[model samples]
Target: MTTFHAAEQGLAGLELMAKIREFERRMPLLSEEGLIRGSTHPSLGMEAVAVGVSLALRDDDAIASNHRGHAHTLAKGADFGRTMAEILGRADGYCHGKGGSMHIGVKELGVLGTNGIVGAGIGIATGAALASKMKGEDTVAVSYFGDGASNQGVLAEAFNLAAIWNLPVIFVLENNHYAQSAAIEDMVAQIDLSRRGEAYGVPSFSGDGMDLAEVYELASAAVARARAGEGPTFLVLDTYRYLGHMAGDTEIYRSADEVEAAKANDPIEKLLGQLIAEGAITADEWESMSARIVADVEAAEQFARRSPFPDPAEAFTDVYAKETQG
Candidate 1:
């Protein structure tokens, strides 16, 4: 497998990370305008983890995401316009506007779905990995969840199953310090989440999620191991979210100082600065890139706004599968 350090791949990853950031940054405004109806979780500061892990995988490798999943979905190669349309409840969405932001599943992209239920993706991804193994495919599956999900029993079960069956799966824990209003410390007895996978004999690793290079390096190793039939690996990515747990959150649990401190290590800026320092990209190129990303996001918004909503009669259609004629 090729590493993300290659010049072209690095630049592509940076651009994708920027696009994910810009896309989620526009969410609050859409929410305020009532364009997004439900609770939308923004993965503002966690772009590096998403892009890094995604860049390590092939298009056929599957991924299951949690509520704060826009980054994961987009990073996994979903269409920007359709993602925005889904959030806006438009008919052109991946789920025909029925699944909204939390339930986007693009089978063609191997993005199994972005679930609303906490820790649910663990089982889904594990099942996907099992299927791939049963089919004798080399593809691996990834499950993305937050620090809060670390405490869920499903994680332990998935770990055990993946280990015993030698299924190819990667469990990525984005430890962003807080689980909604509750801090990670208050929610779990073990602060170092990387050790959670050790009990089940799954090799675990931890890294700074803000550093895209570090994330990519670690994820590449994990992906390689899984593809080699070495069973599952768990990654504890220490990152933080700049936004609230969800839209309309008062954010009373964390201090303003804490938020500002986390913003200082903004992942997008971190990678951008590194690229400039290494002479890989000039400031002018970055400016141009940012402008193009912003324009793309705006166009997606317009597309979602112009697209029609799903018809009421269609709700019952996709719910059940119709029998095929023999």
Candidate 2:
């Protein structure tokens, strides 16, 4: 494994990873406290993948995400308070409280939105890439989905169109081993999901999703390739989710031992250790940074709690075009 020095990379990566961890750690509490009305899939253990891939993209690049996408949104520069508000269905949300946890999106930030369906966001990302090519823009679109989504036929369709048309897009498969409750081993004949891209003549890569630096390096290359009009790439990320599929899942599918083993290599903690070993930050400094992240997340939580819900009369405002004929 390569070591990272804070002097060369600055502390932004470490900070973002910590922030994401803190944000996810608090997500379960939000549900337990009844702050969130609906279900939410936490990206607790997969912060590195989201942060690394998002940090590799340009400001104008677009992204489509799965249900567990809070980290993706935040890493892409969305306001945490507004995202929290959206999850809480408050008026100050990114979607103006219309779209909840499963559909929070901010177009200004190039977030196409998160989808509840398994692989639906792949098509959205492909469509965004096509639009970018049509407009002659250099925007690259990324689709973040889970291993469970890899089986969906839409993914194959997206791969074919993107390859033939040479659209600027990237398909990031977060292979967390389980698709809801089903293990990926039982779902596919071949274990490697990246082969799907190879079949479509697209560049395919698989790497450790828990390593931030590795993910960023691979994602940067893929983003560069797509921006250069070389077509799309498929990146299979080996990651894990600490929590169950949803807030109230019984989690009878996996053992606690398995989850604990994954936690030993916690990406956030690994980054912090590297920073400390490099003398870029002291142990106390690391604690201070974590404390600040905690405060920031708490502030966002309070902001969501204090915000009012959307008014019922405004429901039909942004839904349709004004010029539509009856």
Candidate 3:
């Protein structure tokens, strides 16, 4: 067992950190290269929520995500090659050139998918959990959405449905303080988003989005509670997105200094610093990990570039059963 203590060397814990770092860095570069056609809302400063919530899921567990989902997809174990390829408009991608950057799916890896619609994944996760309960399966469901999506009435309705039926699901709200150009304080009636879950009689808690260990601890408890037939739990991960709503967001919304200041508390930097301080990882280890991640990401990018675009005819084919397609 990997103890959260310094004694365990915290190796597996580092992998989660490394994963987040790679995802955060590679996503923007892919977009800049004009490979990822759809808009990308990078979780630049909010790695902890994805890392924490993912630890709560198993191979059979399903996760549904919203627009800003690179962290969620990576944490859910989507193949970096295919994930990037999907973003790069390649046929070998998760959607096989169908669902681009904002819509990636790998069912075998437990990522049901990333939806473009706000608060849409909530219903999907709820329905999946209900199915698991009825089928007597141990599988649980997780839905990762932004604080911005909380304004959607569908989320409240999902909370009600999950609570009344005792479905095995976890709702992770990554509160990054903005909904496009609107600030969290400007839009929400109560900045305490957890209160919305409480209103539906669901037990809700907040977690530190920059601390993976803290996230893991909270998520573990939430997962166990839901699977034990205790019902759903709402988690508000306090974090921020360093990137704008998309790649070329205007500075009129916020100050450049604010972005730089937020990067100071970046989860990857904080994790690496702690690992070195605790002697769990040496300088060389950090260097080696960085090199490996860079090489891997570069290779995936090359693969995506070489991959062919999906055949236009194929889209009409997956639309129906074999008989219908034939």
- TM-score of every model versus the real structure: 0.97, 0.95, 0.93
What's the number of clashes in each of the models? 0, 0, 0
For residues 223-267, what per-residue lDDT tens digits would candidate 2 score against the true structure?
A: 889888899999999999999998878999999999999999888
Better of 2 and 3 by lDDT: 2
Each candidate: RMSD to true structure?
1.4, 2.6, 2.7
- List where candidate 2 sits over 4 angstroms from the true fold: 1-5, 8-10, 321-326
Model with the higher TM-score, candidate 1 or 3: 1
- Quality of model 2 by C-alpha lDDT: 0.88
lDDT of each: 0.91, 0.88, 0.81
Could you arrange the candidates by TM-score from highest to lowest?
1, 2, 3
Candidate 3 global TM-score: 0.93
User: What TM-score would candidate 1 get against the native?
Assistant: 0.97
Candidate 1 deviant stretches above 4 angstroms: 1-3, 322-326
